[model samples]
Target: MVSRTGLYPGTFDPLTNGHLDIISRALKLVDTLYIGVAINRDKGPLFSLEQRVEMVEAETKALSDGSNSVIKVVPFDTLLMSFAEELKADIIIRGLRAVADFEYEFQMVGMNSFLNDEIETVFLMADPHHQAIASKLVKEIARLKGDITSFVPADVASRLNEKFGN
Candidate 1:
């Protein structure tokens, strides 16, 4: 049996619940799920790459334990498709929360398809309950002392609060 591997790439600047939702769902679709923590210096991430990777691993621990699939959190400093190619992934998982996301991701799919026709891009719609949760907005809410408990996990919320000195 050919094992299916997938790469889910994102900055994951604090690892929100929405990301966790996608990770949990992605596990069911592939034999191995690689959570690619992108080292995007342009985003000016709130958490360092190590921190992001650690947070992903920590949060997904339960998911990994419960599922039959293997889950690995890896940091990447290269282009997304290049990293996927490096992992020899069969698919790239993306989560779409809204039409706005679709517009961007649709373009990405087209470009990535051109990059590697062998690797497929799969889109998972965000659960409606988590549709509005975004890492950047979560950070902004945390910075302003707004409730972020719903947007992130408890550990992530605490980390965000600590980062904001809240």
Candidate 2:
């Protein structure tokens, strides 16, 4: 039987609990999951690629245990569909937070389907508590010396604090 693998791609500038929630839920639908960190040059990410990868690796280490053990955190600089094709991922997992997100994700799903007909996209609704949490907002709040402990992981919070010299 073919191994079922899913690709969850995102910038993940600083991994957050909402992201963790999505990752945890995505694992249940596929035998293996690749959390792809997008290396988008245009975004001017606050964290370096290496730092983002390390943070994701550290955060997901606990999920790499047990019989199913097939979680991978990797960096992808190419198009998401190309990365999914290269990794032989059968599905692309995305998290939907609100109606605005739905509209954008809808267009993306259509484009992704057009790029690779065989691969499917799966959308998971964010948990109610996480519905309003976004990485951009988290970063802004953190930059302004606001409390971001509730939005991201402790390690990420520490990193943000250190980055902002808080």
Candidate 3:
């Protein structure tokens, strides 16, 4: 009786292992998970959208189990609720790592609910191991030539090393 499909929207400037944890957990909560890669240039990224998409695809290869596990990467250029509606997602999945994150996401949830009454957003707390992981932190570490092996997946770590390493 699995009948839910969810849209997880994020910039994912550089897909991290933390991001994968959210995706992996969300897969069990929904039949299909659409990983919406928001194209936001306001915050510059170490990797391009194409590179991020490839990294996401590569990291998610083992999770897609044909029927139940499905990860579709799509670029979102507009409002998240609009993208969710466009995808016909029954739910919107978000990850919450701290109270500060909740403050921001709460506003988004309110705005999204106003936009579409039928759609709901679910927030999953980041695993304790990944509580401090984020794209911003990852970028900063990479900029300093610091090891980010623990922050991102192996594939992502490799890509970051290639791009940021001299």
Top lDDT prediction, candidate number: 1
Pick by lDDT: 2 or 3, better one: 2
Runs with alpha carbons beyond 4 Å of true place in candidate 1: none
lDDT of 1 by residue, 1-94 (tens): 8899999999999898999899999999999999999999999998989999999999999999999999999999998889999999999999
Provide backbone clash counts, one per model: 0, 0, 0
The segments of candidate 2 whose C-alpha lies over 4 angstroms from its true place after superposition are none
Model 1, position 42, has a per-residue lDDT of 93
lDDT string for model 2 (1-166, tens) is: 7679999999998888889889988888899999999989899999999999999999988876642748999999998999999999999999999999999999999999899999999999999999888999999999999999999999999999999999
lDDT (CA) per prediction:
0.94, 0.92, 0.86
Greater-lDDT candidate between 1 and 2:
1
TM-score of each: 0.98, 0.96, 0.94
C-alpha RMSD (angstroms) for model 2: 1.1
Give the C-alpha miss distance for residue 137 in model 1, angstroms. Answer: 0.5
Colliding residue pairs in candidate 1: none
lDDT of 1: 0.94
| Candidate 2: Cα lDDT at 68 | 71
**Tens digits of per-residue lDDT for model 3 on 1-166?**
7578899888897998788889999998898899998878887766788887888878887888544767898888888878888999999999988999999999988888899979989999999999999899998898789999999987777777788763
